[model samples]
Every structure is written in C-alpha cells, then in structure tokens.
Target chain A: MIPAGPAGAHVRHWQRFTFTERVMRSLFYIVVLIGIVWSLQSIEIIPEFLYDAPQQTADLFVRMWPIDWGWYPKVVHAALMETLHTATLGTILAVAMATPVALLVARNVTRSVLLNSIGRFILVATRSVHAMIWALFFVAVFGPGALAGTLAIAVHSIGFTGKFLSEAIEEAKPGPIEALKAAGAPPLAVLIKGIWPQVKPAFLALAMFRWDINVRESAVLGLVGGGGLGMALDTALSNLYWDQAGLVLAVIFGIVIVAEIATSWARSRII
Target chain B: MDASAPIKPPVDDAGVDRTLIIRSLTKAYRAGQPVLKNVSLKVEGRGMTAIIGPSGTGKSTLIRCINRLVDPTAGEILFLDQDIAKLNGRALRQMRRRIGMVFQEYNLVERLSVIENVLTGRLGYVPVWRAWLRRFKARDIERAFQLLDAVGLGALATQRADQLSGGQRQRVGIARALMQEPDLILADEPTSSLDPKTSVEIMELIAKRAGERDIPVIVNIHNVALARRFADRVVGMSKGEIVFDGPPRDLEDSHLLQIYGGEGWLE
Candidate 1:
C-alpha cells in the first residue's frame, strides 16, 4: 500500500477525474451541447428576436387597444356565460366520480392490490396526458361544443383530484379508524364516519382548486374547437378584429384573478 | 301475573351466560417468536378484571384476542357457546358488536361533534345505508344524548372532540363504549394517556358503567394501585404467560417482582 507517493498524483490537481474520465465526460457534454444546438437550429428559432420582442409586443398591444367596449354586452351574454357553465358542470361531475376512485386508490383504504394498481395507473395516465389532447379527443367524438370542453375538464380533474385526495385519505389519522372498527362499524360505515370526515377538508380544498384551474383551462379549450371564450378569441383573431380579441383577453384575466381570490378565501374559511 | 310482564323460560336472564372462555390462546406477529404463548383465562359474568404486567408482555394482545381484533395463532375463544376464533364475515360482525374496546388514545374523531362520535357506537346495529343519510334512529339519538349526560358531557355534546381537554375526550370515549351496550368491554390501557386524577376518574367510570350494565370488563392496566382499586380480579403476566391469577388483595409485592421482574420498584 505504501508503494505509491500519493494514489492519485498522476491525475491533475484541478481535475476531479483521471485524464480518460475527463476527456470522455467533456466529449459527452460536447455531443449533448451540439445536439441541443442542432435541434434549436432545425426549429428555425430566432435568438435575435429576444432583443426585438418588447417592441413587437408593444405594437401588438397598440393594435389590441381602443376597447371593443360596445361588443362586450353581446359576447358576455353568451360565450363568457358558456365558459362558466362548462367549468361548473365539469367540476361537479368530476367530484362525483373522484370520491369513490380516491378511496379505491388510497393504499390504506383500498382492499385489493389489483384494484389499487389499476386506479393508480388510470390516474397517472390521465394526469400525464395534457387536457388539450383530451379536448381534441372529446371534440372528435362529440362534435365540438361546451360538451367537449366540459368532458375534457372533467376527465382531467379526476387525475388531479384523485391523486391529491387519495394522498390525504392515506394520511388520515389511524386512531379514529381503529376506534370505528373496534365499535363494530362495517366497512362502508367506517369510510363515512372514520375516513371521510378526516379527509373532507383537504378534498374540499382540492376540489375548489381544480374548479379554479378548470375555469382557466376551459377559457382556452375553444382554440381547438372545444368551446368557450377561446373560440371567440380565435374567431376575432381570424377576422382581424384585434380589439375584440383584446376584450376576450381582458375578460379572461379578470375572471381568473377573481376565481383565484374566491377559491383561496373559500378554502381558508372551510378548511 | 301482570299483563305487561313478558313471558320467559324458567331461567334467570340476570345471571345469563356472559362468561368468556379462552382455551390455549397463542399469537405471534412473526413466524416463530410468539407474543402470547398458549395463554388461557376465563372471565365470569359482570365486574372488572385487570391484567397488569411490564411493558410488552402481551397484555394488550390477550385483551384484543377476546374481541378477535388480533387473531390468536392457536386458540378457541368461546363467547356464549359459539367459538368466535373460528367465525368469519357476518358472524364475526355480530360478535364484534357485543364486544366494545377503549384505546389508550381516546381515539375520538376529532372533527366530529361529541354527540355524533357517541352515535358511531351504534353502527353495527344500523344498516350501512342509513348512516349515509345521517339517519340514526330517534331512540338511538335520544340514548346517545342520555349517555353524554351520564358521562357528564351533556353541555359539551355539540362541541368538536378536539376542542376538549384530555379528560373530557376520554369521557367521550367512555360514553362511546357504553353506547354499544356490549356484553364485554376491553380497556387497553385506557388511563395511560391520562393524568393520575383523570386516570382514576376514567377507571371509576368504566367500573361503574360495567357494573350498571352487568357487562364484564378486561383492562390492561399499567398502574397496580388503580388495578387493585378498580379491578375485581388481578391477573399478572411475565414473558407472555399468566404467572398470577387471584383476587386484588392477594397480589403481593413478591408477585409484582415476578411479573415486572425488578425488586427496586416495589419500595
């Protein structure tokens, strides 16, 4: 063992690895960097546009201003209302569906391995895919309306709410469940009396949060012919009515801000 | 005979068979290392029997075995002539309703109101679907209110369980146990989480209630003084076997040394 002056003296003092390791790592990084550059180049991305972005944005805003204030009464009566309808309907239906699924997915509550895994896989699958794709699928099947938008949001909510609510169910206090069981409460009774009450606050909070997100997401679903304000925005942009599109953006911004405030306030009070 | 007097066979319902018989009960969480080693004890109708031992001596397990909460590895627990150890499904559920348990932790559903937690004790008697609608029978609700009053929590019935102090919560726990109208009550160190005064109060409540109802109670107690004070019979265990079984007056310091395995604490 004492044969060497220092075991790693041959390696450079500044380097953490041997020469071969250093060369191989540097070469690997160089290849990765070149690959990223090549991919960016292929996409025809203009890095220089970053400098001109502010100016272009300002010009776009100028075009969008001079509010289509008169057109608001006409659009608000139908499209904006439809967007709200889609979000509310989707949230109601999703919560109805997610309650049982969440119980089945929670490791502490679920009885069977096969059933639990299937529930987990379904949640993971739905969560992994984007809502836009769900909208497209529903649109293709249902022929593009508030129905498509509602179904899309509903399906996505199952993933979001199911995963979060199941975790809350799992984290529920075991003492209460044990007490309930010791009282000879049946399985269903135990769920209602023991588990549900403990997780209810968290589930309510998540449900409201999902509804908030759905309102925003539903607003844009119309771009892909699902319905709502996105359709109105798409139409205005296509017809070169920049002022109308600007009004739609303003409405969306206003609604989202209000919804966030409302949801958080409600969550605080309820929880 | 009075017209309202119910017809009955020539037998005493007051002294009816509420006796619990256990034959060679054994339990092991893992393969070979057993927690209870072929233990057997019988509890007669009514009054309190306390099991006292050092920590981890399978006292809780033995109490749980009577209710079939922890399955005995090899045993027969005969409650009212039926072998509960062999029962399953609906039969087991029927058995469990008659056996109430109190935990070391009061284990109240903290978010629920005191009255609602008390009503959960009737879950076995009511259909599951009825609970979904919050539809407890009127009599059960009225009885729950009575139990709350009996437990000295009548004013706090509407309060959330977590809002109460430790003793108040344990009072609710006792009310819940009584609500079951159980034939046997298992108190698994019911006073462990309580202060000394509260512990004595809880024991008195358990003993008084079981006496009123003529239901036998098995308690896994840590405090020997409380055991001697409340328990009609004291069973001592060491290394998962019952080493002493007699009336409370006979549980001498020498037996404590044998059961708890130390001489210094006796002083």
Candidate 2:
C-alpha cells in the first residue's frame, strides 16, 4: 500500500480498527486457539495411528484394486435404491411438516409472541442436534431399519427447511397482502394467494438445496444400522473386504452426484 | 345512539337513504395521542368526496378508519345498514367484500400477470381451495378480462405488473378495485405516485367509474386542483379536523390558506 504524498499526509489510516473491534479480533483468535488445543486433548489423539494412516490407506487401496466389477451388482441391490428412497421420502415429509411451523414463526404472518417463540424453539432444538444423533434416537426407538433412517432425516429437515422458509415469508412484500385483505380475503387465503406468490421462487430454491443435503445425509444414516449405503460399507469394512467397501462408496458417490444435478435442474426451472 | 351496543345491521328509519354514516371517529396508534380526532361525516347514496389536507394531518387515517384498516378509537361507521366498527372475523370479511380500496402505491402483486391481479379482487368471494388453484367462475374470468380492456391494458393482460409503467400499473389497480363489484370505494391518494398528466387521467377514470355505479367514493388526496376538478364535494382538513365542507366551487384562496397554512404557496 502506497502512501499518497501530501494529499493524505495529515489523514490517519482508513484501515484502522475501532477500539472494541481491535479487542474483539484479538479475543476471537485466542478463543479459537484454545478451542483447538482443548479438542485435541479431549479426543486423545493417537500420534502413532495418525502417522501410519496414509501408508495403511495406500496399501489397502493397492490390494483392493483391479476394479471389483462383480461387487457392483451386490452394491446396487443392497443399498442404492434404499438410499434414494430414504432421502426423497424424508425431504418430502420434512417440507410438509415445516410448512405450518414456518408460517407460525414468520413475524408478519404470526402476531402471537408465544406461538412465534414456540416455533423458533422447535427449529433451534431440532437443528442443534445433527442427523447422526437423530438416527441414533430413532434407531433405538424403531429397532434400526430404513424406517429409523427416514424418520431421522425428516426430523432434522424440519428444523433446516423451517428456519429458511419462515424468514423468506417474513421478508416478503406486504403490499400484495394489504390489497388482498382489503378485498376481504381471509388469513389463510392471504397466506396462499397473497404471500405464496412472493415467496414461491425463493422457497423452491431453499427446498431444493435442502433436498440435496438430505441425499448426502441419508446415505450415511445406515452407519447405525438404519440401512443404506453406509450399512453396506460398514459390513464390508468389518470383514476386512476393502474392495467391497470401495464399490459401495463408489455407488453412494454416483447417487449423490445424480441427486445434486437433478436438484440444480429443478431449482433453475422453478425459480 | 349508544356507542356500547352490540352493533348489528341497522334498521331503516324514516325516508332518508344513508349509504354510510360516520359518527365521532377517533384513532390512536399510541396510547394517548390520537391521529384522527372525533371525525364524523356522512355520505348519502353516491358521488365522489375528496379529503384534502397537508401531509401528516390524518387525511389517510380518516379514510382508513372507515374500512377498519386503522381501527377508530371511538366511532360508529355504518355502511349498508351495518356498523363497520364492530364486525370481526367472518362478519368483517363479509363486509369487506362489499368495499374496495385503491392505494397510493398501486399495490398489485408484481410477480402475477395483469389479468391475475384483477382477478385477485374476487379473492374475498371465492373459496380458499378454489383461490389456491386459481379457479375462478367463468363469469369472474370474463369480468376480469373486461376490466382489463376498459383500463386499455387488454393486450397486456399476460404481462407481469412490474413490467408496466407507473401509469399502467395504476390502471391495473383501478381495474382490480372495480373487480370487487363493490358498493363503495376508498381511494387513498390513488394518483399521489403518478406524474402530473397521469394523475389527471387516473382521477378522471375514478370519477367516471363512481359516476356509473352511483356508489360513494371517499378519496384522500394531496392535490387540491385535481380534487376540485374530479370531486362532487371537497372536504378540507387541518390539524386532524375538518376546516371546510362544501361543494368545490365554493372553495377559494382563504380556504386553501386555512387548510394548508401559509399564503406564499397559494401564488
């Protein structure tokens, strides 16, 4: 950065931070440094295992190579269909359940303080816990299967979709709503006819983005034996069949790519 | 008349046909300071009545109060043999269907097509499910198209509202209000956002519509010239109170001075 001669000679540097901002910046770095150290200590990092990981991974891959084409049919039958079904069903259910909650939480739509706070609380509570933890809860409740996987993803989605969608509704233009209500449209009608049009494009984008995330999340719900590609991968890993595990991972990757493309296409069309 | 009575549809008394009767209406957005203070006016049958005042003098508040958009702190708004001040829920909705409102901003849903916005005026009369599906009766669709044609946007019916010019959008707004098939119309400075020429055109259109219907129109306007030209009666307000109430021909510089204050602007 060059100092512009006498023109700005008497002027102080514009890049200077305020007193509080300077203090906050220093404090943030210190807190992050402390967190990293604490996490490493708490997890009991094994230096020896970490050092050997790369070598072990390379050796395993070498033995598993020569393309396990025979394992492709097994992977497709075992987990591909289940993975797709779980994600699609979970996303649909989650969006459906989130719709009412989103409306109640939107400040413009909902005037009640209690209801708005309750809606916010549900979103916060659900979102704070990840899909993995939700899978564990449903696995224990439903005895572990595709049912548990679907329910887990759906529950987490309620929080995810609700938070974004409600904000969109709140930020929507109030002009159309006033026009509709003045014409004697009811509250529900105001939502569907007046508010819906304003938020449809934004909501479509948000839902499609969430659906893509769910596809990735549902693939691994089977780690807890909820039944998908993750469960098949787990089985192959346990028996030390690295080639079979590689095949299952490849299938999961293919499905995720396909889902991502489809969602992108759908989002563009609607928005 | 008792103010505390459970207000219902009023029974016809004597020979006078009152389309709307307002008595002692006041509004306060805050606790003690009222924006509209004890405003009372009556409209018999039809024709346009323009309310003119300085900015922040509660001209908009007065018109909004009649439709219960801004609930009056103390008032009785009798329209079509019913007390508008007391209706709630379904009853209020039913009453609103009979009244149409035009805003200064011309608040048509920008994402919707011109014709679709005109049809929105019938939203109050249709079932919720039917409205969601955009299913209007054949008659309503036909009327919506006719209104678009009347507004001279017949070819632009499929165009989005945001694509139209300010003048064109206001025309769509006027068409939307007429779509309600309302018994009364409340226009809140319907031309305030338009250019001078467009303003004149809008006022003329409104006068023509109200004249044809014989329904009363209570308009809150800022332009004295436009109001006088279009209104059957001109109402001048100052400091949230009516200062002048008579025909437009009777108003002069003295009345304008009193309503808006300061003599320099009159020249």
Q: Pick the candidate with the highest TM-score.
A: 1
Report the TM-score for the A-chain of model 1: 0.86
Local error of candidate 2 at residue B193 (angstroms): 1.8
The B-chain TM-score of model 1 reads 0.94
Evaluate candidate 1 and give its CAPRI docking class based on DockQ. Answer: medium
Regions of candidate 2 where Cα sits further than 4 Å from its true position: A1-35, B1-18
Candidate 2 DockQ category?
medium
lDDT of 2 by residue, A1-271 (tens): 5567977676556857998999999999999999999998999989999999999989988867755668767664658778778888998889998989999899999999999999999998988999999999999999888889999899999998999999999999988899898999989888887899899998889878888998899888888977788888788889888778778777778888998899889987986
Mind sharing the TM-score for model 1?
Answer: 0.91
What TM-score, to 2 decimals, does candidate 2 have?
A: 0.90
